[model samples]
Target: MNLLFSNDKRGDYPQSWYAASADLLAPFAPLGGVQRADVCVVGGGYTGLSAALHLAEAGLDVVLLEAHRVGFGASGRNGGQLGSGQRLDQLKLEKMLGAEDARRMWEFGEEAKALVRGLVERHGIDCHLRDGVGWAGSSAGSVAELHDYAAHMDARYGYGLEVLDREAFAALCRSPDFQGGVLDMGAAHLHPLRLALGLAEACVRAGVRIYERSHVHHIQHGSKVVVQTDAGRVEADHLILGCNGYLGGLDRKVAARVMPINNFIVATEPLGDRAAEVLTRDVALCDDRFVVNYWKLSDDKRLLFGGGESYGYRFPSDIRAVVRKPLAQIYPHLADVKLEYAWGGTLAITMKRLPHLARVAPNVLSASGYSGHGVGNAVQAGKLMAEAVRGQASGFDAFAALPTPAFPGGAGLRTPLLALAMSWFALRDKLGL
Candidate 1:
């Protein structure tokens, strides 16, 4: 099945409140003929743009090809919660990779967050960058777990988190649904599309050649790699495949290690004073559930609620309908609010619940499987990939050393197996198991 074209046609940016408020920018031209550069990056989202910007700044000629426009992928459509650490817990990482390596990973995440803030300031990217994020508990058990986790972070990692009890949590969020939660000031939220567009512009300023609508059809790997697109080609000493979940069939081996999962989001009409009633703090909100509910109030006061997932490539016909129930479950007061927009994007996941970063072939590096935690990690991945290409590779090698198991079934049956596995997890969530 040609999942890419099908999803591409169906995946129009659904009247998002962000899109409505963002400043208009000029479009990039598509690739037309053969070209050459020191590096060719596929997928022009945060990862690609970051890599391109860093490489170009280092005086390496860089060519970035995007199938659509920059930020058209998950980079633009995400919930904009820039949280710390990977998708998996730090304790889990410590257990899996040892304490020393896990500490390095944690520091890397902090650096990623710092890098984002620095870029925003350096480029004057006005994307509504805000401090702090809330991890609210969906149940009593989850509340206890959150408190314990907070204590763990404080004791083991010297991280400070404001732990709130039920009453205090309700006061902080103005929602009766949450039992309690932890607020980490280190994490944050922002207008993701704006940030991505700013990065693309910065890359151009740094002399990176960016081409939109340039879908790479094939990659001929050798001493120097040659990437072929329908209208153009790029020969480079290094190639960085940052396509993530939308990779399509670019490389079968790399594709098999990451499964594409579809996640959807909805935006409600500006609630004005009513928004403040629901969320006292403007911090981004996320729940402690298997199918987590993540949301935040936009600069314009519209609530950007994100939830719902499909393991297969197909998206729900009525995204709002799929998400409304979950939204209501969290804040019943907003049940009647008019949904202004709905959209969906794909994120890659691995069986081990860790990012898959490795060299698929000689001189060909790929990084994906961030799961739903790409905001900070993807940027770091791009920077690390650039460093690797420049011969300083210890940081990138650390990620490449992480074990990532491919789907049990090969490409043909992988989708079905993943659907079943995710369905089971959703069922467990429903049963509170």
Candidate 2:
């Protein structure tokens, strides 16, 4: 089954808290006839929208096609935490790509956050952007390691982080599972769907032709790339694949390197004053679990908790139940609380847990496999692709130079293989290994 059509209704967003609470824009019409543009961007998440917006601003005729609505994918349904750095820590990156490249990567990651903030401010996208992300250690050893990493980032890059001891962390998080934690003041959180819809509005204002519900089924690669949807087509000078997890057989090379996975989240009933009893602060929180659990209080004081993953095509029938177990693990008092909303989203990951940016063809660029750091990475990837299309490719080349290995069984068998590997890691996490 195609991930684009799996688990969710065609041409509809999931019944997510983000969707319910967002000021969603009126749906853009699907593409219905042949069109020509300077660039055709497939997939209407952050990457496509941002790229289209930037390109249009640069006086390029841009067409962005989305299977359903803009931001209807992981961009609208994620944890909404825009944390510091890439999916892999910078220290690990130093060893993998050497200090120079790693340092450049870190700088790019930092600039990604700045880009998001600048976009929001300049375009007036009111997505409740807030700073401070908490990194709680799952174990004492994990806690110590987090502390050391905090120091490392602060010393190396002058990144600001407040390391909290056990008592202070407990006062802020009120979680027995979370002892001491580090608060990255530079990181941020926001209403993801609002940000996406806001960007779509900005794109339209910037002259981007956005076609919603226009699913791309085939692509003809050449000097003039042709993108085919059921009732419409786009011929453009450049093509960008921002499909991420929803990409299905669009490009074989990208498919081999990027694997899609499902994640679930739930929002609890408004906690009122009890919100302070649970989390004394407004910081977004995440732990060091192999399958990480992240949570924060919504503007209305509801607890928005994201956890659980499945190595399958379908989301669990009862997403609420699937997430409740982990919610109990972190906050027992909220275990039986009323679930206001529960939803699942698909996101892609690379073998090394870093984003994969590649020039799949001379004029066709693809960016995906952001792991859990898409909020910042996706937007930056979009801007870099926009730059590359204008013949300024140094930034894009830097990202493309990072190695992205194909999965052992490629895309077809990766599901089963990933299932086995994730099960092993989950078991190790249970055993605290």
Q: Best-fitting candidate, measured by TM-score?
A: 2
Q: Residue 312 deviation, candidate 1, in Å?
A: 1.7
Candidate 2 residues 79-149, lDDT tens each?
99998888898889999999888899998989999999999999999899999899998778888888898
Q: Give the TM-score of candidate 1.
A: 0.97
The CA lDDT at 429 in model 1 is: 77
Q: Candidate 1: global Cα-lDDT?
A: 0.86
Cα-based lDDT for every prediction: 0.86, 0.92
Winning model by lDDT = 2
* Model 1 collision count: 0
Tens digits of per-residue lDDT for model 1, 1-433: 5455556643234356666677746777888878988899998888888888889999999999988778878888889988898788788999998999888888888898999999899999999999989999968988998899899999989999899999989998877678999999989999998988899989999999998878888999899999998888999989999999888888888888988888989999889989886688879989887878899898778889999898776788899999998898888888889998888888888888788888887798888888888889888899989999999899899898888987888988998987887788888877878
Q: Provide the lDDT at 107 for model 2.
A: 89
Off by over 4 Å in 1: 9-14
TM-score of 2: 0.99
